[model samples]
Target: MESIYDEIEIEDFTFDPVLQIFQYPCPCGDRFAIALDDLKDGEDIAVCPSCSLMVKVIFEPEDLEEYT
Candidate 1:
């Protein structure tokens, strides 16, 4: 199985209201991103578009209220 590059709190991510996605900096310079809908659906993986690295996002379902 592939390994996650890191485990990051949702609080550490930056939310883009226009994109409706949470993002974090990846080592490869591209941001790791996951959509809000995906999060709402209990998905936790944030992937970097330019690389293979992925981070496991840490957040409770209630935490999504602020983003919504």
Candidate 2:
């Protein structure tokens, strides 16, 4: 099975603090934007608006540098 990162094609990613979200374009033709609160404890379930796909993301404190 392909990983979520592989499915999303997230490279050189960045975050938006004003929105409290992480924005990245996905390979599946959707822009995957996740809220900071959603990613608490390194795991979150998010819905993709373009593809109507559900995604599970695992995060770490290091991954949230911008939000902090």
Residue 57 accuracy (lDDT) in model 2? 56
Tens-digit lDDT track of model 2 for 8-55? 322334577688776666568876777877675554555556775555
Error of 1 at 31 (Å): 0.3
lDDT of each: 0.96, 0.59
Model 1: what TM-score? Answer: 0.96
Runs of candidate 1 exceeding 4 Å displacement: none
* Candidate 1, 1-68: lDDT as tens digits: 86899999999999999989999999999999999999999899999999999999999999999988
List the candidates' TM-scores in order: 0.96, 0.54
Question: Weakest 10 consecutive residues, lDDT, candidate 2?
Answer: 2-11
Query: Which sections of candidate 2 miss by over 4 Å?
Result: 1-12, 54-58
Candidate 2 contains a number of clashing pairs equal to: 0
lDDT of 2: 0.59
Alpha-carbon deviation at 61 in model 1, angstroms: 0.3
